[model samples]
Target: MIADSEIELHASRLMVMQAAWKHERGEDIRHESSICKVFVAEAVNRIIDRAVQMCGALGVSADTPLEHFYREARAFRIYDGPSEVHRMVIARDVLRSGNRS
Candidate 1:
């Protein structure tokens, strides 16, 4: 049983994958999609951070993929509406739903 932190990271990746599938199928996942985007973006950064830690000095070096991943993950949040904005939207939806259970 691999109980590494990456397992949670994979759950984030799966959220994105499910969102993509829903989009491809023309399903309306707007509010939920924003939540997934926020989750995945944050998760990618966490996963990359763990990778960098595991690789030690090589992680930050230009010669390793860890460096590339770290660099790219920084832009993911910005390109797709940013996590803050998405979280706000999610919160708005929850409040609007009025199903506070």
Candidate 2:
């Protein structure tokens, strides 16, 4: 779970950097940020869920920090951008790229 979350975090940072670079190169980045944030949040949430499940009841007990982690993970999904919004950005980007051919 840690590995998955780390990978997601790295991917998100890379996407953000790519968007900024594209903006600097005169390409539109309005969608990239939205997509990146959504993907990252989703990935992290999944990872956290798995981690919580693996830890069993302790993962949710107040005696452990996992509960706090779980709460933060749930909250993150609502921030930046939601999963649906990101999916739309990705779909639009794909359609616009004309790579479907």
Candidate 3:
């Protein structure tokens, strides 16, 4: 699970980098940014959840920062446009472009 989460994190980072590159070139990155927001938000939540699970009860305790991290990660999914909304944006863009790939 940890290995899978690491791969997901790396993939999310690459997506953000690609979006940043497009932005640097003065191209509109609305679609790319939406993808990044949804992916990275989920990736972070998954990674943090794994950490909390590994730490067992201590992970939820106030003695560590895991709880705080988990809470923030959960909020990340909702604040920057919910994942469902972003997914709809992505789907609409793809359908409008007629690009299945």
Return the top candidate by lDDT: 3
Clash count of each predicted structure: 0, 0, 0
Candidate 2 residue 88 Cα shift, in angstroms, is: 1.5
lDDT (0 to 1) per candidate: 0.81, 0.76, 0.92
Tell me the TM-score of model 1: 0.81
Model 3: what TM-score? 0.94
Local error of candidate 2 at residue 98 (angstroms) = 1.5
Tens digit per residue, CA lDDT, model 3, 3-93: 9888998999899999999999999899999999999999999999999998899999998999999998898899979999999999999
Candidate 3: worst-modelled 10 consecutive residues by lDDT: 92-101
Listed per candidate, the RMSD to the true structure in angstroms reads 2.8, 3.1, 1.2
Q: Kindly indicate the candidate among 1 and 2 with the higher TM-score.
A: 1
* Model 2 lDDT per residue over 1-101, tens place: 67776787788788778888988999867777777677767777787787788889987889878788778878776766667767787788789987722
lDDT of 1 by residue, 25-82 (tens): 9987897688888877877788788889888899899978899899989988877798
TM-score each candidate: 0.81, 0.68, 0.94
